[model samples]
Target: MPDRIEQAKRALRADLRERRQIVSSQTRDAAEAGIKEQLDALVDRLGARSISCFLSTPTEPGTHAFVTAAVARGIRVLLPITREDGLLDWSVATPETEIAEGLFGLPEPVGDVLGPIAVNDVDLLVIPAAAVDRHGMRLGWGRGYFDKTLGSMEKCPPVYAVIFDSEFVDDVPRDVHDQPVTGVVTPTRTIALASHHA
Candidate 1:
């Protein structure tokens, strides 16, 4: 059953990736503008003084503006640094922070490596996802890095997955290790999940 489910996830990931690749830069920029505005509102609603977030790649829903803007507003921001052992380290992200290519070709912060427990300090977490289901189950990249991180948290903050407007769907494959998010922030709306664990 797990194998079949994982196979389905692989197929879905391929499809989503292809869809993202075909989006014009202009459309993506427009979507990102809306997303940034929505994220700012979410932060205020949650009173999230500290946030853990990912630096998005070009093809993903752009988080570049949101991260920088949040930092400028004096919100404490932490960005992940992929480690070789599949665990993620974190570092404080400022507009001036130096970045370098890290694992999985992600732009990682270059400075002191705050270990995984750094996540416990955040009031909210905004993670990257390929897609999110109506139930808030997030389909992440196959690496399981975020899954492992969430699984280890004893008292997680409100975790939200950031996805494009079209990526929210009716269902996504689930495994025992998969953690559902509290909500999804799309370009057009913020959908709070009934299945939110925290």
Candidate 2:
């Protein structure tokens, strides 16, 4: 059954990837600006002083502006550093932090590496997603990095997945190890899914 679920996810991800690639530059710019605004408002709404956010890849809804602005605002932002062992290390983000291509060609920060457990202290987690369902089931980009990180947390914070406005769906295939997020942040709005309080 899990295999079937994974297969469905694979097919869905392929379609989503193609969709992202075709987003016009004009739309992309507006989306990025909107995403940054939503993220900033989310931070203020939650009163989060420290958070973890992923550096966006070019095709993903841009988080680069948000990350940079957050650092300048004196918020502690931890960026994910992919490790070979299928776990994530982290790095604190600053205006001076340099980005380099990491595992799977993902954008990662170059700096002092903080171990996996470093994320436990964060007040919020803003992560990547290929798509997320209304119930908060996130379809990641065929990688288990975020799932593993989220599942192992002792006391997970208000984890939110970042995606384009159209990536939110009514349902998605999920397996036992799949973790539901507290909410989702899209280019246009933020949704605190009901399951966040479950």
Candidate 3:
């Protein structure tokens, strides 16, 4: 029998595939609004200076609104760079920074790449996900980029999965190595999960 994580992943992949195919402009607008509201609330709750979030891409849910809100609040922003051997390095993004196409057509910074910082330094991490559950489990695009990078961190930041409200579910299949998030942000509201391990 497939484990819980496997089942959830399969379901989520199907949902995301369907969503990708027929995402109407109206749907996109609504999702953007919802994401913006939740992000504003989150930033307010955890002051701007205390958060460091990853810049999102257009193909992913909650991309533009989240980044715009973060930037407007003067919160520090970081974008992931695909490094040698499939590793990810994050560098700060500024107003004048130019981005070039990187691995998988992802946008990366054109300025000097910053060295890796301790996860503890980031009070909150807004991660993009295909799907997220109420329990904070996330299903990524299966490249293992986030799992690998986050796995090596000495102190994991408060990871929060950013998704459309429809992408939030009751459960998702999780494996031993799958890192669970502390919360999920959707267009509607922020779903907080009680720390499962502590």
Candidate 4:
């Protein structure tokens, strides 16, 4: 299963890079707008208070529109930092917050590290994935950061994996360490209440 997942991840990564290369700036702009609309609707429905999400790195799908919308709604927005052991820790983000490069070249908050908060403290968690199945199982970039972090959470938040529509699948190889999401959101729609416990 791990080998299969690795192959799938490689394929998906190549596909994404190729697609990004050919994608016109105009198309990307339009996609960003569509994604914003879907995410805004999902955020409203979820009614999250304190939310933990990722800042978009170039290869990822999300537009960061959800983060902006959350801030606009006065929800406490948090970002993840890759810890030394490949685990993730959360820190708060405000409009004026400064970010610095962290592991894997991801930008994270530069202010005082607030450390990990209880998962239950977060009403919603916008998760990043390379691909996700209808069953809510997610395939990340083969780093167990999210799995480790989610496992340590006392109370799991409502997890939502963000992906491009084409990246949503009917099945994906899962392992004991793989963390599942509660739902998935794409540019066109949000599939609600998808259980990851299958």
Backbone clashes in model 3, listed as residue pairs: 4-173, 5-173, 5-174, 34-187, 35-187
Local accuracy of candidate 3 as per-residue lDDT tens digits, 33-118: 88778877887787646454555556555465566557666877776777767667777666666778888777667776765553
Give the least accurate 10-residue stretch of model 2, judged by summed lDDT. Answer: 189-198
Candidate 4, 4-95: lDDT as tens digits: 76786678767755765675667666666777787777677777778888886665565566677777779898888888877677777777
Better of 1 and 4 by TM-score: 1
lDDT of 1 at 84: 88
Count of clashes, each model: 0, 0, 5, 0
Misplaced by over 4 Å in model 4 are 1-21, 196-198
Ranking by TM-score: 2, 1, 4, 3
What RMSD does each model have against the real structure?
0.9, 1.0, 2.7, 2.3
* Residue-level error in angstroms, candidate 1, position 134: 0.9
- Compared with the true structure, what per-residue lDDT tens digits does model 1 show for residues 1-198? 999999999999999999999999998998788778889999999999999989888898888889999999999999999988989999998879888899889888898789999999999889999999988899998899899998899888889999998999999999999989999988888888976475
Model 2 residue runs over 4 Å out of place are 196-198
Model 1 scores what on Cα lDDT? 0.91
Off by over 4 Å in 3: 1-11, 48-50, 118-120
